[model samples]
Target: MEVDELDFLASSTLYRRKDFLETDEAAKSHPNRNYYYRKNADVDRLIEACTTKLKNNNDNTRALFIRASSYVKKGQLEEAIADYSKLLLVTPDDIDALYQRGTTYEKVGNVDSAIADFTTVLQLNPNHVKAAYARGACQNLKGDFIEAIEDYTVALERDSQRSVSSPKFHARKKDLQSAQAYGGNTSGVPQDAAKDNLGTVERGMSGLSLERQDSMLGQAGSSAAELRDSNGHFAAGSSAAEPRDITGTSASAPGASDPQGAEFYHARGFAHRKRNDYRAAIQDYTRAIELDPKHFKALFNRGFSHDKIGEYELAIKDYTQSLEVDPRNGYAFYNRGITHDRKGDYHKAVDDFSRAIEIDPKNADFYHNRGFSHRKKGNFSLAVSDYTTAIQLNPSHCRAYYNRAFSYDRMQKYHEAVADYTKALEIEPDNATAFHNRGSLYERIGRLQEALSDFGKAIELDPRSALSFNARGLLLERLGRIDEAASDFNRALSLEPNSATFLRNRGLCHRNRGSYQEAVRDFGQVLAQSPKDFATLSNRGYAHRKLGNYSEAIHDYGMAINLSPDSVRLYNNRGYCHAKLGRYADAIGDYSKVLELDPNNIHAHHNRGISSDKMGEFERAIKDFTAVLKLDPYNANAYFNRGSAYDSLGDFDKAILDYTRALDLDMAQGGDGSSQNAKQM
Candidate 1:
């Protein structure tokens, strides 16, 4: 194509200086031309010169470079790439060519190739600011903020004199703020890998960016009054005076007597916060507040720093002060609400979150946080309403959807919960928590296959998620995959050695497999971690009873009953243990307690009768047996026990009548009428 155009141009007189440089007189006579004909003539001349040169010597690298630059200026990126490619074939080590090609690739929207070319340019000249900035932009687009920040930092360090006015500095600062907010992972995962940690890390860790926080707090009167730093000391304005130490304040401190000094401290605090040094940030912000009591930004930023360090009371105080300084600070209220929620004061949290919503009615975070407080207070219906509002405000809010699902789960609305979880997963396909929780909901609704699939996906997405492993183990156990369940439980235990829940679940699996000794060992480990756990004590007692260790079983059951004195089931278990150990009187006492708590307990009545007969209390035995017969007319054992009691008391006639009724019931129940008790009667 280039050869043909060059041949035609060489043959035509259009390339003549007179014909090409001068505009046609006739066309010039016309009006409404958007561009000058002379400019078009010049472009034609440049193209003609390059093409003519290239056609004469097909290996002319200079002509190819000129033509590629012209094509780039004309928005013909593909033609430019071809020309640059030809030039690079001749001079592969040309840094300028690589850089120009990289920028052309960016214009053509081929970010990977652009990044590659820019990286090559950097390799040739490590201090190439344009290459660093261009590569950083590409990395940001690929969601590799950590690497982008590194590139931007290098560029900033290499060009610090231009840092204040450069867009690279501001872009780097913004990305750093966001990376800190989301806990930027430094583990070097692939740039294009699917993200599984979307919104799963800590929130509110980002407060401000040092160089670009003017929108949050309006700037001072003059450019010279902007926050400035020398060495590690921060100050405001052109004051060459030394910075006052944050450890102890002085009248000549950075924030002293200057309206913009508080901003200086605030900016420095943000720098500290970016390094995760919340304590130092708090000191800076506190100094800022001391300089200007009504500095709302400083007050709010201090509160955030305090919250980061788990000093909820101090955080609340700072937020309250900030609100007092600026009565319309919705963020102050919202942050205070979060602090209250962390402190377990749900009512206060709800009130503050409600106020925040009233001030900033359109913020989805306000509604979502309020809903979280409601859920904590067990108000599931209100939680659902808030979460719905949050979703309506921002339909793609996956965290809101996830929280709403939990609220639905608490209300026993399994279908609604499952749908919400599914919606969350739709918005964020790699949300492992959503997958794990939805699997639980599926299991609750008896969708076992769906539950299995979700659990499997959750484990795949987050291989180290102990909760997912434990939950899958429980589902597998329910499906009778005992070995698989045990394996998962072992994995979970290996990950979280002190997880009592995992220990208890594994113990239950052991009991189900009839490995009483192993079950006892696991339950004992759980008890060691949580000595007062009633369920673990009861489970261990059952294992001991299965192994015929009646004394140990009775002791465990006694401890469990002490923890939950009104538990009728605990009393029954203890009664059985006592009876197995030939402690008839103790067994009778436990059964009587069970009957006292539950007047219509048929099992308690029958067990008490058996204990009475064992203790030679014929009258009490007969009474209990009569009560059992009254409750269950077909109770053959009750009639037989009563006949034995009568015989023991020498009432032969009554004993014979009871014996006859017992024999008839035995025949009706498919039992052979050949009992030693009846024959003796």
Candidate 2:
């Protein structure tokens, strides 16, 4: 099977000519049209001729090989393999026959058999490039990663040697040296092989493609499509002392005259990429592009390498260039969107993702990534819609459910959020973020025990998650497990020493445990970092008040009030601090402000009543207390306080009536009639 005959076997052999009608009147009537037909021998006649040649000489190796190649071209792998086997019996040590048979086995998905044949070829000729490369691909298909890597290494070393020693390479090197005017120092310019961090798991936060499970051999060199003839015949080439093109086509043949050819550089670049030497790979891709600027695969793979190194902008440029050359490349758009998302240009990411979705409407990845971008932009409703479509397309898409749950959480749809998180867990049971987020949702809905269980599971799955520990600690504190909560908080703080949320949560636990000074210390640390943190300031004020540091407590409350003037609680707290310091007028003013903001605030009314009473304003105190009694009809404290105010004004009769009502209310509530102020009066 010579190349020309093989090429002809892969093309049409029949010829045709149009037949014309000879009626003069008809031809004159239809002058613009011609009606003629002619034909040559049938295409099957060519196949018949090849079969006749085989029938005449059944032992002819070329006839057997050509017939086998034709069978392969017609997708008859069994017949092709059989023919190759028969040819192999005649010439038992034929490398080409063995290589072709191996490739045929691969086409039929009999990878183990393919590997055996390739192994036999390597044993016969250890330096056989095609056999080694084919064997590596088979090993990779079989999930034998280590063996695949060894074969690829051998092929790459041979390829590199072949490239360096070629006469064309030396001439090109000299030309480069002359062009750059670098003198003769190009002799030993050391180039470092890039480190292989490609094995590191990607976060996939922006939906970038993650590391593939198989070894990287598949990314190198021509794919199966490029290796086959036009008629689908796979002609495996044998190398001479100088390497030949693996596809067995003279058009792609490597030679001394074409040192800077795109095919040569693309093969080398792919080899370097497989080894995770991305820097070296990029250089080769650049040279390939310099030779053939429209090389889309080289540009895309170079972008992928740049993305691995976190060079997002460079990756985007390469992807854009690749897309310009091949506008229908949806994957280029998808990856470019990922880079945009990583760069926090979420609007641009959305546009690119939309383009990808338009190009590849059935791809679930496009919808999922678009959903992620929508989520980042806080467009929760749009995010949920995209995620829903993705889930419908791929029922097992765990990340889609997880992200949808997050969007639900943002919308405060706790029940929906919990359901989505549960779905995500059903798909990926060990997803720690799903557990953590679900736990938080459970806690929000007051499912304390379930929240605790989820938090524990999250911690078990991801032991180093500081946020999980903090969440569990807060729940424990709420459940009155103060000692356990403190331990968890300590661990959380150790993991993330500067988290203000953790500090505030721990401080609350301390306050609940009556560790006032320790509570102050934690709150103070948070306040030091965020001086205008009203919540922390107010928390520290409460701690100070517990310690009876009235002045300090008052100052903290005033500072908190300045930061949040509209906060009802801050005003109430400041009022209490004023009352503690016997600043009755200031306390009354603070309470008035609280009342102005919330006119029906019962606590504010009661506190202001006390402040007025302290200043001997009995009439105003009685009115405020009366209002509290009206709002809360069974408020015994309010009745008793009003009674006391009446007594102070020497209205003993009304005071006695109010006190009687207070006693009646307390007895109705099954009380022992223990009214402190009433008894004092």
Candidate 3:
């Protein structure tokens, strides 16, 4: 190095060789002394050094081939094709030139031209494996499955291990196999039946097995058959073989072994999916995506796989990605909706379903699932609308009718509810729920015989239906058949375990049968589920009082009151329990609260009056008696209680008047009214 250059190299920021190489002194070394080369310590400057060598003299075929390869690498494919063609014209049977030109033709999507070039290479050297592989791909594209398979078999036989082992090597072999399984061309598939994978030999589909085509041909070669096309050129060199754009020159794909204007990876990926090889399918899909990132189908298929394998988050992301490319894809929306549903995000599921429906309203499944999401969210009205739309689109959709009926039943639109259930039954003759629900409506409307018949049908459809058995037990109990009610309740319990409502209802049957212990057990379980269940609490408290457990009864009554202090029936029962416990003041307090909430509660007033009289609250007793009388003027108990209250107050005239009134009302009804009046009081 020069002294000044060394000084500059030391002074001017020499982080590495580059710091020194960029100096004016380094630039002065040679015409091609690039800092980039200097930093690497290479005396050669690639292109510039080559120009120096060419300054001597050069017409070497090897050099020509090397330059052609360089041009090919630089995407100047036309220049590369010209160079290879000129070199081959001189060295006609040069295997390297032939192979290079063959591959280059294949790259340009001129598969027919490629096949001719490879044919010449194979003719000169019959064992050319690459030529065979390339010819196979071209043949496959041209709908010659037999020839393609033959070429592939030859290639595999000649070179079981590819010297130039590239992705194309494996890719071409796989596509050839697929072509053999299905038909050579895509359009050869028969959509009327099952399709073959590649097109070589067909397995049974739609009860027909296609005959396999002959693998290899004789010496004729396809070129002899190619020249008669409408384009007036050899089939391999025809416009169909090469992509002929609006411009005079043909457009070529730079990638090798793939077709010019066609997406071979996409076709191969679909082929793999058809063969149920998901991994290979994914590989091809990935390659297709690398080639064309916006391929929505590949994205969707990959996403669907993500869903099938419980990778829901990944599936959702992929579906979202597909939607970015194809905003109106209903299938993508529908699939995303499914993922959202799996995640239990009902609102998002519904929104996705809505968008999918907006894009393709004819899809009944989307509406049905959306309806289910709405039903889960407790939007029964909206659920009914979605379900109805599903039904309207597909009348034979049994689930839609059944779900709509459930919504109708919840809304208390009984007649419309019955119609929907009936429609569901018409579609599915053995529908047990339909019969059971219809029976419930019948029982509610006082049609006992019809209700029984429907219940019988339900039981026949589903012999183990707990709901049907429970309903029948309730009906039998109401009809004064206590023994029959107990048997049905027992059967219902056998069918259903740990059902709070079933337990509570069966407890009522037990109570009627005087099995108070069992009744209390059942009601206790129901109370476990809903700790504040006033009805079950009150019922169990009554059972306790009946069993002479007054203290326990009072405790239960207090719990019931805490839950529902405004329930008149609950208060009346609690007051009865308190009265049983001899806590007259407590009984009176509970009765007062019930009356305050329900001013016209007859039982509350009657019970409170009795409790007041017991506590020596004569005025309060008299007031309760008058309230009862207002509710029912003929109440004998009210008259009796008021007479007693008046006597206690030391008002003999009012007491005698009350006694007379009680006797007269009781007598005027001819003994039946007195018992009835006693019942009323």
Candidate 4:
């Protein structure tokens, strides 16, 4: 059959639009008005024409191939496979038929079958780069990383020998690197190829042209005329030279003259980046830039890879270069903003994000990241505004809601913070960090029950999170559930044994429960890690005092007082330890310092009175006791101490009056009205 005969058959049988519309009322009503209907109609017509041709000549390979291609376009994978199988049976070694069938199998997720077909194609044509690339993709999908790497390497070697580069060559190298990076597994690959760490922005591997070409018969640059022989009939034994575009149009095939293009290097770099091999990716991206300094995708992707490896300055430079080429590239601006944020340059981050927003105002991630920069800069109000805009753009943006809640909390808008957290949880209920943060906010606002529930939920969702355990422990301790608090703190410590915060918290709980030795041990551990910690020193001092280790208590208190010289509580605590250790002069001096720092300190006045009386300073003891009484008129201990001082001074009348008053006050306080002195510090 001549090509004219086939063309006549196609023209007559295919696209019988007027005849079909006249017979079919639905077709008439639609009349090519809808794009979907028009497309389906064309495919249906092509299938009908191909079927008629096959009915006349059952072994017509061209008819079968055309029908199979139509079926693929219509998304009828089983039918397409059937047609390709029939075509291959007619011509057992048809490379096009086998490759198409393999692709169809892959589309239907019959990976093993697809691999078998591609393997056969490789056997028939050892230099078939597309077959090698296709098989590698299938193997990669099946988690056969070693096999995938081998196939990709084979494809790369073949392309290198050809001296003419295709994008697939770079893609093959990329897939090889990715396979090696995974080391026979498929973890760390982006679930969505278009998105990277920035979540909503297109980043790594997005620039690679890797879509399957289902509509074309031969290779790229092979026109319909080229597919025919000199007699204008289909050339059944023709081999494809390269992969084609799916739009049935020919793109200029890469020539040997331009084998190492910027795009090729960029593609290879993207693959390396996908595997987190940032150094290798940076090298490839740099080579691409050197080849074509104005290559925008190469520049942008190099920036992304640089940012990944913490080369913020280089990343910024690359992003700036990309922007110079295409100032409207929102992804470049957004990624540069992220790099700036990582470098602690929030002002620059905010500026970059604003530029990204100006280019692509509807991008929620742009607003979201800008909000993060604002929050980092302590602009809580601005952060909230940006987050709100992000939420408005994408209602299901859980991070935006969570971040907005954080800004609200920083602004002290407790109610708004809680509401945003609730909204974020509604969108993503299993977000453990959100739950933990919300629990903290609840605790801060005195909603103890809600706080406990959220903390528990956070722990339940993420049992490995030491933060969740610590937060719950703090809340439980506040609620007086000391045993439960201890359990949580222990768990937190198990997760992070060196956490001084956790140790301090547990120590405080132990102290409250009168586990003085345990409290001392925990506080000591905290001090071992942070020797200059004043709070831990004071806490250890109190624990030692409770354990009757007066010397150790005095040492801790002295260290704490040195760290915080104006701390009245530390001075008073040290003075109490001094009195316990029979160092009356030191105790009096510490108490005097406390009085100087805080004149109305009742403990200091009363304790100083005892210390003075112990040292036989009767008049000075009376003055300190009187000071305590002035500060608190109903102080029975103060009155009794004053009586002792007066008795020592030989003022018998005043001593009797003061003693009588002390007994009356003690009686009123429901204490035994015995003529005993107040308990010593």
Instruction: Give the better candidate number (2 or 4) by TM-score.
Output: 4
Better of 1 and 4 by lDDT: 4
Number of the top-ranking candidate, with TM-score as the measure: 4
Off by over 4 Å in 2: 1-284, 305-313, 343-351, 377-382, 408-419, 443-448, 478-483, 578-681
Q: Which candidate gets the maximum lDDT versus the true structure?
A: 4
C-alpha RMSD (angstroms) for model 1: 17.2
Sort the candidates on lDDT, descending order: 4, 2, 1, 3
The backbone clash count of each candidate, in order, is 0, 5, 12, 0
Candidate 2 vs candidate 3, TM-score winner: 2
Error in Å for residue 49 of model 2: 20
Give the Cα lDDT of each candidate. 0.68, 0.68, 0.62, 0.70
lDDT of 2 by residue, 1-681 (tens): 343563354343322212324422333444455542221223344345457767777776766676676565555678878888988989988776787777778767788888888899889978665566667656655646467656655755654556677896576456433312211111111111111111232232222321221111111122322211110111101100010011101111222013335644554555566566778778867987898888766677778778667798898899899889878767677778777776789898889889989998986767877887787787989989998999999898776787787778778898998999899789878867678778877887989899899989988998887767877887887788999999898988899889776787788789889999999999988888888877778889999988998788989999988988898988888788888888989999999999999999998899899989999999999999999988999888888899999999999999998988989998988889876462110
State the local distance difference test value for candidate 1. 0.68
| TM-score versus the correct structure, for each prediction | 0.57, 0.59, 0.52, 0.74
Q: Which pairs in model 1 have colliding backbones?
A: none
- Tens-place lDDT per residue, model 4, 353-452, is 8998998899776787788778878798998999899899999877678777867876889899889889988987876666777777777788889988
